[model samples]
Target: MNITTLSILQQEYPKLMEDGIIQSNVPLKEHCSFQIGGPAEVFCTPYTQNQLLDLLRFCLNHKTPYFILGKGSNLLISDKGLSGIVISTERFTELTVEQEYITASCGVTLKDLCNYACENGLSGLEFASGIPGSVGGAVFMNAGAYNYEIKDVLHSSVCILPTWESINSLSPILYLKVEEHNFSYRHSVLQDKELIHLSSVFHLKRDNSETIKRRMDEYQQKRQQKQPLELPSAGSVFRRPEGFYTGRLIEDCGLKGFRIGDAAISEKHCGFIVNLGSATAKDVLQLIQHIQEVVYEHYNVKLQTEIRFLGEM
Candidate 1:
């Protein structure tokens, strides 16, 4: 634990208590979908966009390393762990529907967004009903299943500015900086700056509420049948290579049940890497590397991981 970090956080936000923050020695395994990571130097969850901005600004001013984590569903943190701060957006959840659009804060879950749409008799987000991640995370990776993605429905977003403001609260000055951002597939202009995502606006269509609910239920069932939802795993290990599915290629290489330490290529779905009982970050990394090697050797297709690797190796 960095005493300096803790002291500064306390000074800036008196509302946060020592118990509310996690220390470096505590395992980070519980934070990720893979359940395989060491620890973070400091972990904090902010409840509002203002608090998040304050944290970001503090890190920048002090030259401390920091990370913005969401649901941690698509990440592989290293065994050596993080050297600095890790801020979780879990408490920033706020959802609302205005006319034909659904606006959600960065911490809102995809499942929550789908449920909201279903309740409101809106359609077009059924495919994401089973997606496991935060809205900011979903937008960052263009997360999809059943051939639909956030990019397909996103109207716009409220992205924060890194250098434009010293205070945590948003004002007219912050709004001006937000306007300069650009968005695209699995990316946004915010990626270049330390700015964090505040909320996102998704365009949806009004439809029969019953029909939308049915579709959502169907997608959930399909996911339950196809994915190893019962286990701990990063949903998908690799992106689909152009004209080729990563799962099929891995299966073809006869690596479906391949294991490294406690990490195994999910027998339930070859695209996933699951933790059997206790797995390490190295185990997942080795498994991914072997799969990439074997798949490339057999079919000459290089598989790229969909999961982001974090912390020190």
Candidate 2:
């Protein structure tokens, strides 16, 4: 809308921008992964839990569409720019060790968590040593790799209501915790709503710190050698179709290195759609649609998207 309307909303919702909330109309491309997306109408980074809650309430009251941004690793934002508020959880960083459990905020990256766990002599997170997404995004998608997933070790998580100032709770009003969430394969109950992830508790096993470090190092090296880390990509583009592997299917279809504008299906990994320096969101989306059509035409099974598309499609 207009600046006047935004000003009026700010006046009506003082708690949202009391400290003059961080807003940017034209942020640089390098700030986000994928190196794409136009500009955000308003980009807000709430540092505290209270700040996040207040902003959510404000967005809800104003009927302003908002999207939660984490590491920008598993998303494709429209090149036409986002029309509403962009809420960033990058400031929700907090990590603590309690007994054999590791409690980390949603903004904490998987690499950081794995390193922390290794330093503290904890196991069970070695599988996530090279994962690039943040704790919130990983947990939301039940992210997994190398035979383990977030659901395997997640004890519970704390989440805030999407449109309210309160945290998600049960019928008895129990506070949001990891166990309270209903997690499935690559999915969670929080997926249906716009809830903001606060933090998560992971129950890990105590181990030799040096040994944990060695394993993490090994996994990191393996990932660097295999994954197309040099390019901008949203990990896997499509989910496994039924009993079929997405990568194998694409490979079988001879779709490796398929290009659409600057977007190309990663030949290094068939499951990935990489932005080769100057790919637009439109190009990537078109490539995805093309892959879907071809795969469905040949195999009768429809592949699903694991990446989250934000802003306008």
Candidate 3:
């Protein structure tokens, strides 16, 4: 951003500065699972709903671009760096359980949510036990595993609809029921609309604690056995194409173990692209492009990435 805008933010949002909740020129590599990314011009982590609203209002009023960051498990940030502010909801970690329902903030990790459910003898979230992402990120992508998705258990969500009028009026908050979200395979209404997820309520079933634990353990074991868990990766690189399993198709194309720079298609799991130490964002991008080209040439099916790419490529 320009100096004028920066000065305006620093002057107007003094609480953020005083609390050290906002920082300048923060590196993003450490925050994401891939361990790759350049710096963010500005980074802010709001601790409460009011603080979050203030931050959003300031950005909207100033017409400054901002991106919401979750666990960063399914993200690829450009090496050139992001130009505007990055709002991380890591501080919004509140979680509560009441009867068969569990409410979790956007920052709560999927693992933590699953563990909490298991501890409370709630089933349904066992399938997400091994997914590496925050609750908001999962809900944003309608994250799924083993044929179970977030939509299956989602009851409702609290969101901020950053529509043009809402941003101008500073009236962004919205409470949406499950049907309103329009969840589908690797997608949700949030993907298309200018909606920011705040928290989610999941409706589950009462189950034996031991049974929940057993199911969670089984899923984790399966993930470890099948995925390249030992290395740094952004999980599955591509969405499943219709009538074709992504991994099997890549393996059939002999793309497994293929490398560009330090990024490689995982031999253990062909669907994944692993950061084999010192991998750059460029390396991963090139590898992905190469995979798409070769896979299309051989199998005649185009692959779409499941992970989100931020900043300029």
Candidate 4:
């Protein structure tokens, strides 16, 4: 932010500091699974959903730029850093179980959600057990694995819209049903809508905890065997193109294990790009562009990224 904007932020939202919800120059790498990113100019982790809404309202009223961060698994942030408030939902770890249903907050990890479901004897979240992202992000992207998806069991999502763009008259919050999500492969209504996911409800079925655990463990084992889980990296780098497997194509082009700085494709799985210690965001970005170029030239199939990019490069 410029001097004027920084001054305005300090003058207008001194309460953020008092509430212990704000910090300055916080390192982004410390919070993400990739272990890559520069610093955020303003960082906030609201302890409560109400506080998050308040923070959003403050930003909207002032026309301040902001970004909402989840577990930061499927993201590639720039090393040059972000220039606005970064509100992390990492603190929103709330979970509940009622019979055959599970309600999970946006900050809750998929691993935790699956564990809770298993504990409750709820089957159907096993597919998400191995995903590294948080509930909000998963729901936003309709994250799935092993031929199963969040759309299969999601009952509804509680989303909060800013009052300025409110759809409800009495309250800005929305209880969006699963069908309203319009879920498809790696897509959701949340992608097109301006709403913040507060929580989600999953309609699962009763099952033996042992059975659920077995399924979860099986999926986890498969992920560990095929994915580059030992390294610091975002999951899959590219979406599977029609009639083509992304990993096979990259491997065919002989780009597997190719390195650019500390960034390199995983020899184990050509689909993933791993950090070979001290990789910068620029390195990863450059490597990703190179892979896309190579793969597209060879197969005439453009590789679309399954991951999201943030900040300035």
lDDT on C-alpha atoms for all candidate structures: 0.80, 0.80, 0.91, 0.88
Tell me the tens digit of each residue's lDDT in model 1 across 1-313.
7778877777876656543644445567888887888778788887855566667777777778888898999999998788778988888789999999888988999999999988998899999888889998886666777877677777877766656344444451233122344545355565666556778888899999999999989988998998999999989888878898788888888988889989999997899999998888888888889998989899998888878889755
Say which candidate scores most in lDDT.
Answer: 3
TM-score, one value per model = 0.90, 0.92, 0.97, 0.95
lDDT of 1: 0.80
- Give the poorly placed runs of model 1, Cα more than 4 Å off: 11-26, 164-185, 192-194
lDDT of 4 by residue, 1-313 (tens): 3455456666776776678888788889987888999888888898886678767777777777888899999889889778878999998999998888899999999999999999989999999999998999999989989989999999999998765555323477889999999899999988887578999999999999999999999998998889889999889988879899899999999998999999999999999999999999999999989999998898888999998899887
User: Best candidate, TM-score-wise?
Assistant: 3
**TM-score of predicted structure 1:** 0.90
Worst ten in a row by lDDT for model 3:
163-172
| Sequence-dependent TM-score of model 2 | 0.92
Candidate 2's C-alpha runs over 4 A off are: 1-6, 9-20, 28-31, 164-174, 177-179
> Residue 120 in candidate 4 has what lDDT?
88
**Cα lDDT for residue 218, model 4?**
93
State the lDDT at 207 in candidate 4: 95
Clashing pairs in 4: none
Rank by TM-score, highest first. 3, 4, 2, 1
